[model samples]
Target: MVEANVIYVLVAREFKKFVRDKSRLISTLVRPLIWLFLVGGGMSRLVTPELGMSYMKFIFPGILGMTILFSSIFSSLSIIWDKEFGMMKEILVAPVSRFSVVIGKALSGTLISVIQTVIILMLFPFLGIKMGLLSICYAVAIAVLLSFCISSLGIIIATFYDSFESFSVIMNFIIMPMFFLSGAMYPVNKLPHVLQVITRINPLTYGVDALKHVLLGDSGIVDFPIVTDISVLAVSSLLFVAAAGFLFERKK
Candidate 1:
């Protein structure tokens, strides 16, 4: 009962914070839409790579993965802020277990990311992309998994950083590199050998691959099995969340 209450309270607070941020609410959808319309559309004309899928089709799921990845990682900044403001210490002293606190935060971030994903999907057909009704279920499953995995990663990062400013610097240093290398905007095959190797290690690469297969029904040269991708994400998320809990308890 206490663990449940902890999760419920954390999620409610996180949702309220999201609602209060009007600019963030708008920019979440606006920035991705602009990229899809202006940048992705223009680049489609120039790059005629015969990947058995239209440029827009290929990039759509990548952008979707980008949404979850960015939202989850950025969510860690909230944790850093809470720490700086001494709210984290107050929460730490609550009756709930540290595991509950960490996992609750991860789940809250995952929910927020999935909401952003729905907005992104609504704009897909507007960009001349079509997906079957069944694909929506697949997309949701993939998004939720990606959200869990990414949010767990955020918790891991939150354990390391003490302030939002330091976290922002690390975000720029870490998140963008991961995004670009994840094949979110382009094919991994076209990248250099080192980058290709890096992509293979990136959890987001598997996510984009899995989502592309499910959403766009297109997987390029990459033949990532759905089971393998899902298993990797599930395992990684569990491990990361456990590590985050351990780190947080030690910090306390």
Candidate 2:
């Protein structure tokens, strides 16, 4: 119960901070909207999807993944901020277990990411994509799973950096490759043999694929099986969370 409260407080605190940061909220929201319209519009001209959906419609799911990807991963930047101000030291010395701290931090980021994803989700109809209530629920579920996975990965990476400048450099190295290689903009199979393999290995690829399965539905584009998407995300999330907890323990 105490550990649960730890997570609860962490989540509450993070969400409240997010809500108060108006510019942060708008910038994060705006990026995805820009990508969907400006970038997606341009790419649609050159890249007609064989998936039976318009290119804009096809990439909508990927845009949501992009929202979650950026929000989820950067949400862990809270850790560096905390560490820089010495707040993390206080948290680390608390009576709660290190695993509890890991869970707390991970859940906070996941919750924020999902909130951002949901905000982007409301734009679907404008793109001529209709989502039933069931589909929305499924998308939220996958967002939660995917967000947790990315947040765990982020926390792990943040542990290795003590400052924002160094962290931004490494994140730039990581974020773009992960986004591009995840097949967010194109079908994975169209890539060269090596890239196809790398895309498959990307966790974001599975999340976006799962979103495609849920949102697009029976379009028969035939990426990974939905079962494979869910299974990979679930297993990878566990591994990521456990690894993050271990690192938190060792670091403190």
Candidate number of the best lDDT: 2
All candidates: TM-score: 0.93, 0.95
- Residue-wise lDDT of candidate 2 within 93-201, one digit each (tens)? 8888988888898999999999989989988888888789999999999999999999999988888888887865866788888998887887788789998988888
RMSD of 2: 1.5
Q: Which candidate comes out best when scored by TM-score?
A: 2
Worst 10 residues of 2 by lDDT: 44-53
Over 1-252, each residue of candidate 1 has an lDDT whose tens digit, in order, gives 228889889999999999999899888878677777677888888774776656776688888888898888777557888988999988987887988898889999999999998889877676566778788888888899888888888888888878776855776777888888988788888899988999988899988888877766644445477788888888888888888788878853
For candidate 2, the per-residue lDDT at 65 reads 89
Report the C-alpha displacement of residue 200, candidate 2, in angstroms: 1.5
Q: Backbone collision count in every prediction?
A: 0, 0
- For candidate 1, give the lDDT: 0.82
